[model samples]
Target: MTLSSLPAPAAPTVSPWTLSAFWFGTAFHWLLLLIILIPANVVGFVGEANKGTYLGALTAVGAIMALVLPPLVGAHSDRTGKRLPYIRLGLAVNLAGLGVMALAASLMTGTNGFLVYVLGFLLVQFGNNYATAPYSALIPQLVPPSLRGRYSGVMGMLQAVGQLLGAVVAFAVGTLNLPVFVSFAVIAVVLLVPALITMRGVPETATPAPELAAGPTLSWQQLFSYQPFLWVFITRVLFALGQYSVQPFLQYYSVDVLNQKDGVTASSLLAGCIIVASILSAFLGGRISDRVGRKPVIYVAGTTMALTAILLLIAPGFGTALALAVVFGLGFGAFTSVDWALGSDAMPSAKSYARDMGIWHVAFVGPQFIGAPQGALLDWGNRQGDNLGYTLVFGIAAAFFMLGVLLVRNVPDTAHVKTAKA
Candidate 1:
């Protein structure tokens, strides 16, 4: 069957709970690793003085693996017409990597330990990308257009909750002075349980044989030419760049800027504060976008996030920063809630959902590399005196956020609720 002759596949709607379940685990895994464990591990190995530069370099290297793996995994899964087997394989590898990371943390110290941790982190990235690339296609494959916004909202809410959980874990690690390896063990369980629930609960719909046979092989030229997808992809990258510029260094920011005695606990508290607000906004944003439109919500959300980033530069104390974090969370939650729906709507072909969404996933990881230089910049600005680095980086983040909001205007809106109402 040629593409033109293929009929639309029936959309299989799932319970919101089931639809959102797998993401909870995935979000927990990543948020814990990125926001908490990795920073702490880096500090253990490198100490506070050089943490920013080293962490940036380490993250950049790991991001290379994350960036390269997903599209390949997704394309292969599309060809095989299977997602679950790959997900299982990836999960096993991811667990093994976590174990190695725990070993590195518990046994080793200094540069050697950091290198071993890096090796383990690379493996974790590899496995995560391998699994999630195919997993990302589930939304477009399962949900119909009209319901994607609301479903994506639920997914976002669960993701926020997962981050909140991660923050709690971080707080425990900091306050109790828990062993680093123990934290890894905790994350492993947190990741594993929900993933199993999702895999068992969510059934995959088979791709029609004719459509599989007819699906065009993926090519970079074709991928770039899809205008709507390209615009969405660009916007996603911009938003992520804004986010990552600040995210990896929050521990340092709390210690250096906020003058917190235990930076880990302070950063974790800030993260918890943000996530609490995010949980609420994520649901509301998703539902509201369903009724109103994606673009308008995006405009407001992006602006709010940009302003918050700017505000963080001037926050005089942790208390004031905590308040701003709430505002930031509201914006970020809304953006993330709508982001999945936007990407799903802009997908070029249903026949290659995994491949396309895998590429879309890069929009998130690619920024880790692109913005990696912010670490060096942060170090440099501090050297110049008056804590200039934080100011410069956060300012840049605000600019990136605003530019993303502006560029998103180029993509044609595809909100189903408005279309249905019309």
Candidate 2:
């Protein structure tokens, strides 16, 4: 019933008996998760080099999937206490989907080839979403609310690392042919497997308090009546959609309009800039949020994003573009740094938290559908062939962040707020 009576929290045993292995495992898994997406975006964008319509549709599919699957999967994951099984299963499917993507990219060509590519992407989206919802849900279980910021921040930092590392490696490799694909595939397979092996417990942090949200039980619909939870959900969806919408298009705009010597060169450079800015900002913003309050941090990110969006609108050239990306990344890093802590604060029930989070994951995944394609369509329709569409997209994102700033204010302060007794 108390902390002392527990099994010493399993002592984090991993040969050397350190928490580093847990992080190492997480870093690797994070790589597997992020790199594929960056490269896929590069591939997809390059593939759409001339076909903006196709790119728009690609994101449209993701957006649709984002809206539909949450209640379905959220309900199911909630019923079950463990998330590892889903992770393993999802990775397995992802592996198969990657193989299909490789085959299609290598063998197929033309409009038909793009369709096959989309199908493979669909499989990937399903697998990744399945894994991610449960994966994020598992976080609150592994670490306490106190250490949540450190772990979340580190993971957030390393998440950028994974994206940057993958992008850098892909850039250095100089091609996306069979060999390059295999190299990443090896990384994905190798990292994904060890993450499960090192993590010994299932419910990794907290045991699902079934009494509050016991399932079999009800669907995620059980939480529909809980207004605070809904508020958090709305905030998350708006925030994610705005963020995701601007980014991929920005990557594309960077390559298409900026006249980089190489598209990969531009992507890798922008990625590096974003990653570094993100790490520093995440640390800075997170610490500030901890000291000042979460609302201020959200407001700062929203305001900064809005201003940066306008800057891009006014000056859509090389220096201005990178500047906006840097600012965007910093805003994102700050947001993500405290997001987990904030999410934990908002949850109506810690019982079945992972399942509840899986429902929340829908917001994170849903944006790819709405934002990405919309940007692409704007690009196609306007046919400016410049960064005009990107400017519009980010402008809309800034608006959403403003809305989020208002919403996040409603979330009560549940993070470490009081000083310890002297």
Candidate 3:
């Protein structure tokens, strides 16, 4: 069937509160994984010296799962014309993974523990991606083109709030020295409550079976030929690469570079600074993009992030690092706020919303697959003395941010381009 022949349902306008609720839980889970759970698990399993390499390997493997699973699941969701069912299934599986992870944490300090932890991590990745792939279609399916920037802003705000909560959770964990099982239980509750709220709050309309059967299908040839989507995808990949380069290693960086004895607390504080700053910028950035163009806001935001990363490289003390974290947060918030709007604008066909969004998701996870391996490089640089690995990695990240900013100029703004209906 031709794309133009498919029915275009009039999408009801949704409030920002309702539109952004689900992202709270999703972002919360991600924050915990990257900032708290995975790092601690790896460090406990291996001593500090080996932590980087092992953590990198574990993240790489998990990234592979994230890279591959979502697009396939989203395609299936498109075929079935269902999203909520997959979301529910994902929640169940994610909970089960948490249970396994709790068990693995109990056995910390052993090879067996590490292996079991890897298993749980993979399960978590699987569940999260499965849910997120289809859920990502909601913005395109529901919001009008004009309102997407505002909707995306609200989404970014909620996500930043979720990250803040995650940082709080990390603080509690560190202060109380919570047991592994207890920590997992806390995460499970945090994840479940918001997700349930979202499911109940957002309304979904299923495509009729005839429409589902006749909807335009995606092909490899069409995928590469879609210029706007391709450019957006590449830009997203570069931005994410810059993020992952610094994200997973902050705890180690605190301990080694800043000479902080309490790495967890220090890292949490840094994250809190970032999240707090991001919260301030996210909504404003989105709203601004609605008035100005997405590309301009992205240009400013990207430059800020790149500059802040460079400053972080030369920071002399933990206090200085904290300040830089806040600056980086401002840029990160604005970039993320407008990012979804840009991607939604670039979509080629409404019929393939889930599938295309899932493919776009690869731009986020795929970078982790490549960047996580830099842990080896980090270790090698540190071994050479003066913590040069961090300097090298952060430099690379800054370069990536600049490159992403430059490349984004090639993608036409939503106001100028119409989504393909072929």
TM-score of each: 0.95, 0.79, 0.94
- For 1-422, candidate 3 gives per-residue lDDT tens digits of 11232343345346767767878888888898787888988888897888888988888888987889888998998878888898899989988988888899876657988999989988988898888888888777777666777888989999999999999999899999987787788888888998887777665654333543455566956865777788899999999999998899988888888898988889999999999999989999888877776888899999999999989878989999999999999999999899888887777677778888999988988888754568999999989989999998888889999999999998865433332321
In model 3, where do residues sit more than 4 Å from their true spots?
1-13, 204-215, 415-422
Best by lDDT: 1
Q: Weakest 10 consecutive residues, lDDT, candidate 3? A: 1-10
Give one digit per residue, the lDDT tens place, for model 1 in 1-422. 11232223355545767767778878878887887888878888998788888889988998897788888898888888888888889988899899999999999998998889988998888888889888888887777666778888999999999999999988988889988888899888988888888788776654434753465664767776767778889999999999999998888889889999888899999999889999999999888888877888889999999999999889988899999999999998999888888887777677788888999999988789844699999999999998899999999999999999999998766555333643
List, residue by residue over 167-240, the lDDT tens digit for candidate 2: 56555544554453564475556446545653454435334543433323323665655554666678778787
Give the CA lDDT, 0 to 100, for residue 390 in model 1: 94
Q: State the lDDT at 69 in candidate 2.
A: 58
Angstrom error of the Cα, residue 122, model 2: value is 1.7
Candidates' C-alpha lDDT: 0.84, 0.58, 0.83
Which 10-residue window of candidate 2 scores lowest in summed lDDT?
Answer: 1-10
Question: TM-score ranking from best to worst?
Answer: 1, 3, 2
Whole-model alpha-carbon lDDT for candidate 1: 0.84
Candidate 1 C-alpha error for residue 243, in Å: 0.7
| Worst window of 10 by summed lDDT in candidate 1 | 1-10
